[model samples]
Target: MDWIEANFTDQAGLAALLLAALGPDGDDGSHDRSHLLRVWQNATSIAGREADCDRAVLTAAVILHDCVAVEKDSPLRSQASRLAASRARAILAGLGWEAPRIDAAAHAIEAHSFSAGIAAETLEARILQDADRLDAIGAIGIARCFYVAGRMGSGLYDPADPPAGRRDLDDRRFALDHFGAKLFRVAGNFQTEAGQALADARTRTMRRFVQALLDEIEGKSE
Candidate 1:
């Protein structure tokens, strides 16, 4: 919370973005606030090691990237980032931001999505992409994965085919399948060296978790 002012140059602009993205009051008591804080921290840490970046723009992108939350099971899931981007553009414009910086923030917000498949062209965009994906692995990622799965009414895993040994993966139906479907392969796409190192470490944690989960599923763990 204190880092909000410490990390970026323009406290007022950053605060406006937060209000626009997170609502006027901020963090209506959900995991959204925690997730935003983690991504912001990740972005700043990566930016600190890098040569050049617009901290204010990066902060705006981080806050508003998920401004439009589409449920994981929604048919419009793939468009979530694009929708957020469109909204971000308008929000930045309303805040009287210049054209170029607004575009930069909007692009970073949109390109950060895994399903969007848009390459991150700018340093800020790459950092944002890496930072956001960093949150999708490791221990916190495991917790969120199962939490969303439960919300979606998915089982832990198919008991008879825990690893999808016989059938293909269906993350929508089984929580563990999500690890293989996306989380396991996330590290290879990290854009920055710093992000890559953290991603690799987190990925190892996820793999160990999957193994442990499989062991429990088979009653192989003591």
Candidate 2:
């Protein structure tokens, strides 16, 4: 329990430090503090039931998961995971966490992102992965889809050009293509039953939303 408290306390401190460094406005204009908070909440909910999971490691991963996001200047460009691990390692070491736990927490944080191409190897990483993926599917997920799509200059739907091959995705494809590509796969990838259920329900909603959007765009909505 003491370790958990210390890890979380250090996590909060790091979050504050990173937020200050990123400024109150955030890097992506869209990824505000509230968004990070939601990811943390979702991760915590999933982490709570995993008895084999370490609370300190999971909590630290959740809070500092996006510390280095897609923002920031060059030299530091696209180095969120590296920067996060460095900072998190310092915090963990300061709290007397041995090398293994610090390494585990850093791995979880680094692997939490789908774009990172790193798979979750630990129980804590699996839980964090599911929780983070859950955030990309629900009502909030819908919002995030458009937010990210807009950022990437992607359209909402492309009726003529369907997402056929798995390997041909580029920046201009429709937002719905993401579901077929990866979002729907999350339900089966979750580590916990609760996380699986949440992913299933959210995936369904996302599918329905995509269908509705397609229908509306095609003037075929009922």
Candidate 3:
């Protein structure tokens, strides 16, 4: 029997496969093991409420979603999902997955990207999209935004127009501008009811944080 079959009865097999696919070191902290686990939890929770979703496919998709590392602002950023999908197929196939199951997982991975903007064609795909996108919002999302910005050498905000006034929204130059460019828009266009509900709460958290900053700038705290 192949390694997949040998380990078929063991639950840890899935985790082992996903870990290998994620690369030896697991990740570089940004889209690391913790991120994948969070996405997995989110996907499974959404799957519980969604009808007609294949839990196995959704689980595999969540684990393999970020298998390949790509720069956040690379010209190929949007293609990361497509690349990951392609990689997922090979890994699933190696693990003795049937063609249809592999296809379902690959489809979910392909359609989960925000930049790719691909429409999901299956319930599993929709849930995966919603699950992954959820990670990009709320308190954790806010931390990630500044983390990436700092990595890219961006300023906190434009000093001349700190509250995003009188300046074009440019996330590449100012970390604060990302709220207008992307973060603030996630809640309004979710694919599932659960995703939307959670996103709304997270969106509010983000807005409150931004408002506090604005209030401080305007001396409203006094």
Candidate 4:
């Protein structure tokens, strides 16, 4: 089977084009161009290590994965991936991409979302899933959690139940509960070995932060 990398397409140009189309007009400090670039970087790294994965498909998927961003808690969040997939197909077609490549990229985009509940059937889809999910963990992910929390008017922690032991989990009200709710579960779902390795390391960093925060609240810090 022939891989798309053999065609020597101009990925950098496609990346710039996609970013221009997806990037915000103003600096909102949300998941913008930088986020797409990081996911692209992560996808490329994962693709480099995997066999029979279509680099072109992964690149296109990564660039256009978040083209249609919905709020995390929005009811339409699960549909974001499917909508992005449709948009990506049109974008790739306009850029002269062939049908096979466009379809592969679209499938990858459709399968990358956690809320969408789509299993990755292709290697490109798997890598894209891992790369996107990777952005939701680690130090940057922690910062992003707090960023969303702040934006949504959520407190840093629940004063009465800091560790959330006695209360039901509510990430919407307490930013720290996000770790237990979603971020900690991400590392286990990575598809590629490279992604898993990165996710594991990032998860460890997150765990340490959570522990440190707990200890600080308990006055156990040295």
Top candidate by TM-score:
4
TM-score attained by model 2 = 0.77
Off by over 4 Å in 2: 1-25, 71-83, 94-97, 162-171
Which digits, one per residue and each the tens of the lDDT, describe model 4 over residues 2-107? Answer: 3334454757765776677664643434577778888888888888898797666777899898777687778898899999899888887887788988989999
For model 3, how many clashes? 0
What do the candidate models score in CA lDDT, each in turn? 0.84, 0.70, 0.83, 0.85
- In candidate 3, position 98 carries an lDDT of 85
Instruction: Give the root-mean-square deviation of each candidate in angstroms.
Output: 3.9, 4.2, 2.8, 2.4
Least lDDT summed over 10 consecutive residues: which range in candidate 4?
A: 1-10
lDDT of 3 by residue, 12-117 (tens): 4676667776676543566888888888878777777877876667778888988878888889898999999999999988877889989999999999998998
Which scores better on lDDT, 1 or 3? 1
Ranking by TM-score: 4, 3, 1, 2
Model 4 lDDT, residue 169, Cα = 85
Residue 26, model 3: lDDT of 45
Candidate 2 least-lDDT 10 residues: 69-78
Q: What clash pairs does model 2 have?
A: 68-80
Error of 2 at 146 (Å): 1.1
Which candidate, 2 or 4, has the higher lDDT?
A: 4
Write out the backbone clash pairs for model 4. none
Displacement of the residue 16 alpha carbon in candidate 4, Å: 1.7
